[model samples]
Target chain A: MPYHFYNTISQLRQNEELVLYDRVLHFSEEDEQLVKDFLKIEYETESLNYPFTPPSCNAAAALWGAKTVYTACQLILYRENKEAELPLLLPVYNNEMDAAAILSADLCLRFLPQALQQTKNIDPDDALIAVLENHLQQWHYSGIGYVLNAATVNFDTVFANECMQQLYIDRVIQKKDMQRAMLPLLQKKITAAMGIYSATFWKELNSDKTHE
Target chain B: MAEDTSNHLVYWMQLDLVHKDYLAQIRHWDNLKIAADEQSIWVKDFTTSQLESIVLKSIPFTHLYYCKDNLLFPKSSLLPVGKQPAFLWTPIERALPVTLQGFNHNFFGIQQQQALRLAPIEEEQKVTVLLATVQDAGNYILNAPSIRLQQLKWIFINNKDALIIGEPVLPVNGRSYWQKGRFIFPVGYAFEFTVLEKIAAQQIDSTGTHLIWWIDEASYCLLHPDVLQPLSIASWRQTISNSPHKI
Candidate 1:
């Protein structure tokens, strides 16, 4: 009952997701270096204090890493199964703060996989949602989907329903909107599964903002 | 009437004559003394033999005609038969006299008047009276010695009427003809003909006629009228027809 454990620690430690995501995003050498340096710092610091724990060691780092991974996977999925899914998750932010918060979240998400590998016993899904909720209170309303995406093992009905309820209570999502967004993935109408998490995450955020 | 088989290309330009009174005013008027001013005056100094030597040596033509302005002349033609003129004039002493005594007519006086009278009457007078054949005319004029004249009017005859040719005017600074720069022909052949102009002994303000003989498309000479003679057009036709070679 570790919440939605899909990848083993060894697989997460490989950082393959992050590497492929960097390639997909066409990150410049400097940007890649920056992200790598940030992750290495976060991991080294977090590992020094909590030698056995990963997801629980640095909530900020894990969340940033998870968002980054989720964004990359979403873009990949959008490229593959764009015709079926709702067109959400575009890089449009409300302002500079929103853009920066999203960037920070992506960086946190980028570190999550490796963090997950290091942690001994922590529900990654619960830990990630907690970090995203914490960031949501402080930062502008963006990047919530990426955090949730990193927490869930895949974009399944249970995870989507839970994410929809949480966002609704937080005033980040509108009522009666969860099914239209989650149906494509539930019915297997969405050809690509990689981006399902972030896609649902952003769609819920947009729905909340529309109702507000 | 007959097909002109000569490979030579010729065009004639009428030579303007200085008035008889104007010729009298300039006492020492000679071919070498003629400047660029009086170029229209007829030159009557060249002898038939001198003209022949210059024409034959410089130009490759067999015969040259010295005809009158009144004669019914055929349009100038370049027949597709003969060889290009290849003769080169040998350099001679530069102090030769302009007038040669071998002529049988008072060519300068009568012909000058005829040219003057014809000047207003006919369009032919306005055209350049040139007798050209496909020959190396440049070599002859450039290498031949300078000929001195008292007046620019020099003429020759082929039995019926007078034919006129004159020398180009000398540069004003009394510079030797050799110092006056070289003349280049259109045929890309260049020689120092001005070196033959006798400038040291005589200096006059009179400009004489500047005659151009195009030996070929590219080769031609801007010479004094003394360098060429006008042959009878009829005789030229007869000679070409009679010759074994079509030139």
Candidate 2:
């Protein structure tokens, strides 16, 4: 699985060099110039859909690079924003080149605080807590999907409780309006996630514990 | 002298004659002298003169019959046959896979009704035999049509301080019959020639294909090739054959 980071700034910085190479190698002179022009012009929530073949398109490279740099500057400017509202409200950035990396990092960072708290509260008798701690540390360093997959596959009571708690916290924090329609949908997702985690976990548990 | 309660003296004499004849026929087969060791001492008590008088004057009992393995005994010798057999044959010490084919149905009720189709036995493999007889039960008398021996059973025997593993249930059938009662045998155990059911003569379906490994008496596991594969004699055939004479 591809590594993802919780920190958007770190991801943007890492992708900067690759984005630069893509522009130089793949972009035609005309498209490159067009990308440069597009970067200079900005609008407030305007439909800024840049037409370019992602990764190979000069315009796409320029737009992604520009967005990364722009976002980094915005993070700095909004660093003092007590609620971090501007960063949270930023447009959902999905481009093929770094989509997985960005999303995974975001999820890791989003859950890291609760995961750490939950780990602290974990029972000493639980063997799986240590594993979760190690995975959490790896998530911080590797900024990847491995932690999620590992937790999912080797789910124990402690890890599952932590995941559920994290989900509840996320739901409460994200959905302040509390629409009645979305409640059941969110509950269903939570149920489905736990069901899958339990199934995989039990299967591994039974096979591993076999006497023969 | 202990009185023959059933007045089976003539019957016993007749059986003794059959025993002598059977012994003569298989004398060469007893290379290890096991039959000599196991023969009943009662055979010696009856004299030729006594036998001649009984043969001339006495009528044989209806249930009396000579069974395989040189055994001559009354069929109704034991009453209330539901209990486990009292007489158990000592497990053959140096058992070979080839010899087991002949002695597969060593147990009385286990009739080899059908030909056993098994994988070719490798020379190295050895098969062991363990037999038990109900003390009073006569030959061919059974309490139930079928008896369940084990359930979800895994057997391990230490041989030469090394563990010999045996899965009684065939693995494929075992998947579905995991919790369901299934008959399993030890490793290198013969699958065919062992009767899972002993129905009455009228109930027997002679024309139907009889599978040694069973689903039921009429419906057998042979119909499902997967179920028969593991229990197949070839699966247990090994390269090293144990000599019966060694023991």
Candidate 3:
């Protein structure tokens, strides 16, 4: 069977062999259209603020998605740190993100957190940890579940896009990243959004901790 | 506390000042009732024993939200007596993006009326009680309820600017509907209530359907299409001086 990006990741997630990433893999025409439709629909369904702008053409977007998953999985399973080569393989994303990029990357990124957790359990200091973290900072939406350096985010770029900022806050809340929730700007937005229902909505969140 | 002799449901308020809101229930008056009293809320012993001994103030709706003291009728609905009242467990139909006027206190009835405007209700929903209908909402950007009588619990929990029906921040279990570039919970009554930031409302009511905004019988307001505001008693009489819309 032709390699499906999610299925490939699922295999890796189950500790299956790393055989698929080696092939010159490509999704069929039907799969590319499916990827495009999913990203478009999800952007509208999860309205953050701004409108969705496709990152590139349909094929390019799908390819980037496949590449992101393969690379993240390899980084998790392989012994060598693939840090230097990641940028060349999946060029550093532009400062402003497209709905396509975030959603496409998300197919794997959402699952990446749990997979990485297993690695941490086995080897906390594994070289793969640092490599995957760099990948996360580049794709901070996925990093919602991972603890990465927030300072490394391109806020100026993200804030420029209302959709990105809203989605970021949403993902943060979705992930329940206490560290990010404590950010001054984000705390205000989250508080205002929750209004009087903080007790019912996000009960565990302690606003006082942000001050310290 | 007096023993119950009527089938009418009784409710009490519990305040959680830390959250600036409270819950309602069917329990006996406790410290929370004492707190409610400090806010000038009147409570009744509710029994055949003292019904005539007290001064029974006139209220617009009785048995609907029965509370007694020496003076003042209830102005708000009570919360669930248990997790919710049995009647609230029964759901009915309501249209969403509807504006709703609710009782102010957690469960205690206050004198002043509190109205809350909810938005983007695109269609009908199954809720708990019918409360009261606006009859004429006057203008439409909105919708009301056969509301679950128990939503009285959240009468005061303004959690998120826009409610996600019942979803929390994490959408892992959320069933929000995707419409016009935003996510919405089709139902206002949720497992509990979850919230999100408000999104742009669906364009104004094109159908001119008669939408409702539930108002408790504690007080009443009629909307006049001419000025798009709630008509007071005098104004209601003036508008209907010539029209048959008057009761």
Q: Whose DockQ is greatest here? A: 2
Better of 1 and 2 by lDDT: 1
DockQ of each candidate's interface versus the true one? 0.00, 0.02, 0.01
Once model 1 is optimally superposed onto the true structure by TM-score, how far is the C-alpha of residue B185 displaced, in angstroms?
Answer: 47
Q: Give Cα distance to truth, residue B110, candidate 1, Å.
A: 72
TM-score of each: 0.15, 0.20, 0.40
Model 2 regions more than 4 Å off:
A1-69, A73-184, A190-198, A201-212, B1-247
lDDT of 2 by residue, B101-165 (tens): 45554578656465432222223332221111211111111110011111111211121111111
- Per-residue alpha-carbon lDDT of model 2 for A1-212, expressed as tens digits? 11121123234333432112121112345554543444333211111111111111233433444443433333333334433344342333344423222222332133333433443564444333343444333332121222332322221221233322333323332232123112443434333332333233224322433542
Using DockQ as the yardstick, the better of models 1 and 2 is: 2
For each candidate in the order shown, give its overall lDDT on alpha carbons: 0.31, 0.29, 0.42
Task: Tell me the tens digit of each residue's lDDT in model 3 across B1-247.
Answer: 6466566434322223332211122222222122222322323333443333322322222232343442223335344222322111111111011347886667665576433333444455543221111222111101111011112211111211111121222212322322211222233422121232221122222233322222322222222223232322222223334354332
The 10-residue segment with the lowest total lDDT in model 2 chain B: B140-149
Query: What TM-score does candidate 2 reach?
Result: 0.20
Give residue B153's error in model 1 in angstroms: 84
Best-performing candidate as measured by TM-score = 3
